[model samples]
Target chain A: AQSVTQPDIHITVSEGASLELRCNYSYGATPYLFWYVQSPGQGLQLLLKYFSGDTLVQGIKGFEAEFKRSQSSFNLRKPSVHWSDAAEYFCAVRDNYGGSQGNLIFGKGTKLSVKP
Target chain B: EAGVTQFPSHSVIEKGQTVTLRCDPISGHDNLYWYRRVMGKEIKFLLHFVKESKQDESGMPNNRFLAERTGGTYSTLKVQPAELEDSGVYFCASSRIAGGETQYFGPGTRLLVL
Candidate 1:
């Protein structure tokens, strides 16, 4: 079974501070990873995805995530996060057993709070 | 291009009542998925519909949960005799094709059972 674990339940960072949200996934085959963000009272928005090639993937709104095979981790990072970047972050792994399916297993998510 | 849209942004109903959640996928999307987040936990996949056919429904919790996609464009999930445990935010998402693509999500229907 493929599962995702986001260690941080909540993270507080000051404006303009660097941010890193940890995500670890457990899978047997070549894993496809994704990071999504959800604002309060809003639907989730795709931030970035790592299907193949580049380990460091860039996403919208200055967000990026690195996929580390050895660590089994896909960590999301931002050099300098703006206050507007505050939101809930989720990491998902696509199940490939059936071939190109939409069965995404997601993490519990990490709530990010930005302070001034 | 319009994104995936779900009807009834919020619904509050009593236990034993029935609630049907609707999801309208993107204009030409062939795959529609349903997921739910309960008690602030991870968003879990409920089912997936490829056109009017159910592609995968392994994640559905129980028999009380019935999902249907009549016209292959819009889908509905009906919970008969809804329980308190069914209270959560149900999210609907859709992708353009069969591959592992980016799925656009709806605002989600927050179901409160009291």
Candidate 2:
């Protein structure tokens, strides 16, 4: 079955530190990948997505993700961490069935905590 | 433009009671979706609607859950005789079109069953 795995359940980082959140997916074919972030008491927000072409994709809030097909991973990274960036991050893949962009299969999510 | 909006940000009810959740998608968005996250589990798809039609409901848990979108506008998900396992955060999302469009999600309705 197609699934997304976010290995890190929680991570703590100091302000200004670099941040990386791991995400791996299991799919039969080339899939559309996405990263979403949800802040406290807020809805899920799209960070970035990778459809095709360049392996590296930039998203909002200074976030970027690289799609590594060989490793079956699409890890999100940020050069420097911000206290406001502390939130729950989820990795998702579009459920491609019958050539239609169906629902998304999401990972368990990784919670990031920023310490000042 | 307003993003997706869900009603009753939080609800608490006893087992065997019925609760209804509402979602109003962004204007001009023809596709709406319903998803749920039970406690620590990942968010799971419950159903999909294209306008007023039900496109896919493969993720619906069981018959106790009923979703409807009338006039292709706002949608509602009714859970009758709610069970303890049904307690979770229900999310509503909308997209302009289908094919790989970005889905804008609502704040979600957190339901608790005693």
Candidate 3:
């Protein structure tokens, strides 16, 4: 089975400060990874996704993540986070079983708090 | 274009009552999925639909939960004789096709069982 772990339960950052959210996954083979953001009372929105491609994938809202196979990590980073960036972020992985359509396995999620 | 939409954003029902949730996928999306997040738990997959057909329903908890997509466009999930354990936020998502496509999610329907 495949699983994802997000170590941080909550993180607080000041506006214009850089931020990093750690994510680790346990999968037998190369896996498809994704990051999503969910504002309070809103549905999740895709921040970015990584399939077979460059190690560094850039996404919307000036966010990026690096896929490190050696560490089994795909950490999300943003140089300067705005106040609007405060939201709950989830790290997910796609699991393929016997050539069947796979579903996303999401981590518990990290709640981000942006301060002024 | 309008994104995925779910009806009855909030519902509160007593135990043993029935509840139904609806999801409307994107206009051309062919794949629809159902997921739920219980209190203090990660979101779990419940089922997936490819058009009007159920592509995968391995994650369904039990027969009490039923999902249908009659015309391959909109989908519905019904829980009969709901239990206290069934209280959670149910989310609906849709994708254009299968395999590696990004799925868009709806705001979700929050179900409260008292």
Error of 1 at A52 (Å): 0.2
Task: Please list the residue runs of candidate 1 whose C-alpha ends up more than 4 Å from where it truly belongs after superposition.
Answer: A98-100
Residue A42 accuracy (lDDT) in model 3: 94
Instruction: Give the residue spans of candidate 3 off by over 4 A.
Output: none
Residue B54 lDDT (model 1): 92
Which sections of candidate 2 miss by over 4 Å? A98-101
Compared with the true structure, what per-residue lDDT tens digits does model 1 show for residues A1-116? Answer: 78999999999999999999999999986798999999999999999999999999999999999999999999999999899998999999997765437678899999999999
Per-residue error at A8 for model 1, in Å? 0.3
- Candidate 1 CAPRI-style tier: medium
Of 2 and 3, the candidate ahead on DockQ is 3
For residues B49-71, could you state the per-residue lDDT of candidate 2 as single tens digits? Answer: 99999998989999999999999
DockQ-sorted candidate list, best first:
3, 2, 1
Q: Write one digit per residue (lDDT tens) for candidate 3, span A1-116.
A: 78999999999999999999999999988899999999998999999999987999999999999999999999999999999999999999986875347578899999999999
Candidate number that wins on lDDT, 2 or 3: 2
Give the number of the best model, judged by DockQ: 3
Which candidate, 1 or 2, has the higher DockQ?
A: 2
